[model samples]
Target: MQRVPKAALLGAGALAIVLVVVVVLLVAGGGSDNDNKNAAAPRGGATQKQGNGDQGDAKPDASAKPSLTGSALPNGDLSNTRDMKGPITSGNVKDLQAGWSLALGQESQSQYGSYAASPVVVKGVIYSQDLASNVSAIDLKTGEVLWSQQYASPDQGPNGVNVGGGRVYGATADSAFALDQKTGKEIWSRKLIRNAGEGIDMAPGYHGGLVYVSTVPGNNGKFYGGGTKGILWALDAKSGKKVWSFDTAPTEKWSKKNEDINLGGGLWHTPAFDGSGGMYFGVGNPGPFPGTDDHPWGSSRPGKNLYTNSLVKLDAKTGKLKWYYQVIPHDIYDWDFQNPPILTKVKGRPAVVESGKVGYVVAVDRATGKLLWKRAVGKHNGHDKDPFYASKGQYSKLRLNEEIYPGRLGGVIAPMSTDGKYVFAPVVNNSVTFTGQDKDQATDGQTSTGELVAVDLDTGKIKWKVEFPTPAFGATTVTNDVVFATTFDGVLHAVSAKTGKTLWEQQLPASTNTGVTVHDNTVIAPAGLAAGQGQTPAIVTYTLNGK
Candidate 1:
């Protein structure tokens, strides 16, 4: 949840040659006409308006429903959402008390904290994984362990499992695997990495009869050590067989000519399905980001990297490209568009919404990929405009050591959640100082201050925002009228969804950078960074103190 071992501040990027663009045109409904124009980001600032900006009906698409199905949180089509169909109410949320806690063991320790993903619940079992990609099943009522499958393979962070078709799906550092939902024994594990530079860390997704996983650029403990990489793969869920693979950065082969000097492309969060055979996911950044002393200003990798920092949709059944809208072009900072895309309706039209390290929440037409509206959230200190300047060939004036809002670590590092009417995004205001290009790194040793910004789905405007002292790394989870957010320091807060008023708060056993989940009458959070800060790793649960 904090910075990973390698230079990847965030996971997610875009670029293209003819092959990629032709592949791109297959999804061309979403891309801009050319490189420079795309990099300029059309409506690139805060409180911006785009094609038909959706001020139309001023209501959420009524067909959308909050997921009670345990696939994280379902969107209109569903990725993750704050709204829940659970019985937890604002009145009783304030009455919650500690239910149970399960302390983790040595096997759970990882460089980056484990337990970073929100657990999935099916029947009465909770399915979760840690940083090393170890998964376990725990009883929903009692905190007793049902089954544990330990890979102990050190993963970066944000990896978890999905349950569907009567099986649990997940990934280790280099493979996609499935487990018997009842026994926790391995059903099938398939190796999916293309090169040593690629690994898997995202929670796998399920649709139709297939389990889907994506490749991220990482190896050993280093991040982005390969050429433009991230690829998305869909596998037959029943047999664990490969189905289709889509490269997030198609132009890397054509542009870099197979050189491994620069790294690009990857998906950080899981994906949201449109339910009509369409799937949506965000893509990550290009590198050596901001460039080294020699390739300062990203000179080596030119042109708007197509799929990186973009929101894309594909024909889930065929892995065919549908539409792609590059969110940031030629990104110089660690702006990843890799948050799970929430499929919902805005202005009564089917729209897909996403936000990431770029700190802006955006909504677009689900079918045509047309921009609907964009709202800048958190503290945006003009760094977003750098891409536009880079588009104009004036990016040489990049500042060094200046306190940029939404720094490499700033922005929305985790996925956001949504109610039918509003999207709740976790905002991290961490900053990074770009050392002169002589060194290929930016430095920042500070913890972050964050907040939750609520954006109206129809108007694309800020409805309300609540601040936090610690970084709110977890994705927001909402019940009927309550919004639950977990700060990295382990404090979980319950707020009124309508007024942004604090409803309840509880201190967890240890530090956590993951998300919170609401099921039935209980609230569950997993914490396992058991190192310092007077804390220990454990799965913590809470319920109303008294009936």
Candidate 2:
């Protein structure tokens, strides 16, 4: 289990009031092996217009007025905006009452692995999967299982699911597969990795007639050594045939220190697609986790690590590189630029925005990959320092007291919300220390806190902010007047979109680490995996009752 470092603000004296959650669930203890970002909270039943219909039908009409306000479908598409305009308002969010809750998956020997992947609701049925590779289609209205099916062997379960073209798409550690949207019948499955270590932990992106999948073993355990690689694959959606593949960690002949270094450029989230069919995605950190085993801190895998720690744009039709933006060069802090880049227009110029675990949100020209503007959304005290390590087997070689902010876990792991004009990104402000190899030696030296920052899309300016008790680990969804966010501490806060003021909140039984789904006038989210609780995971739903 990954040890969560304790933290407190260094000097900010309680600058705000602590909001209490009114709706609480009775939850037991459990945890997830993977510390993934939660899905956005369910938006109440609100039907919004689709952007230019589907990408397969035609390109997004450039002249069409963008759907700047109101509720849109949640997680139905993989652009990763996390901003599906919903109908939930600050005025009515308090009226949200629990509807029903149901557990997902088979009984696991260990309770730690819950549904890290968010459930995708299509045609009134919820498509969800467990770590054990069990996929089910449930009735959205009655919270009853409609049809349950497992993605046979070689499938390690999916990190998340996406829907399009009358099919459900997902990827496991070693493969990417599709299922019939109506029946859970196996459509087709393709093996992504033959090697042992590398697997996929991303949701597949489906558009036109193609499916995009990413594979890596970067987060399997600790960075071991070289020989492992990350890859991006594109396939025909109709038939599971390879269209093309790109090696994220391609070999570079210019860097001398590249010898014997394991370069890791894993794509951890769903890739974003733009109006013109351009694909955008972020790369994870290069490894050896601490850099002590390879060529030393900042020295191994020399030179930008090519595509790692970078935002890459690809041609959706041929899987060719269109442009690229490297967020940080030679990263050693495990600050992977793993969040999906959200697409939008700035001043009528097409642009894409992305934020990672570094607390930096950047906007770049969508077609050119040129940096437009970048902003540090929160307190980022971290500066690259020489990673220290003693001889193997010696605890004295470790830097036990070294504090790094925008800590490895700080930054924006959760997805952001947008109002067409502004983007609400969640940031965690905490510092971390490397006590020993995979060992927990010290607690957080400073307080671990976070803030919900609203960024003006045009200029990357801070519009407003609201501090949270803990890091917001789930996606933030928004309507016209309200913005919703969830914390690792189990509280979901609904704040005003215009003023960033807290309007309502509900205390869940366990922390939400997956996106919440609000469709057809109902709100549902995964409320499981309470630390040490070993609780069974379930998808809980709510609606505006007695309205």
Best by lDDT: 1
Worst ten-residue run, lDDT, model 2?
6-15
lDDT of 1 by residue, 305-418 (tens): 777889998998898999999888887776888788887789788888888888889999998999999888888776777876765568565777776777666688777777
What residue runs in model 2 are displaced by over 4 Å at the alpha carbon?
1-78, 105-112, 151-158, 219-225, 252-260, 382-401, 435-447, 532-536
lDDT tens string, model 2, 327-428?
777665666677767777777788888887766899999878999999887676645323222112233443545776766556776667676688888777
Sequence-dependent TM-score of model 1: 0.87
lDDT (Cα atoms) of all candidates against the true structure: 0.69, 0.59
Cα lDDT of candidate 2 equals 0.59
For each of the candidates, give the backbone clash count.
19, 30
- Which is the leading candidate under TM-score? 1
All candidates: TM-score: 0.87, 0.81
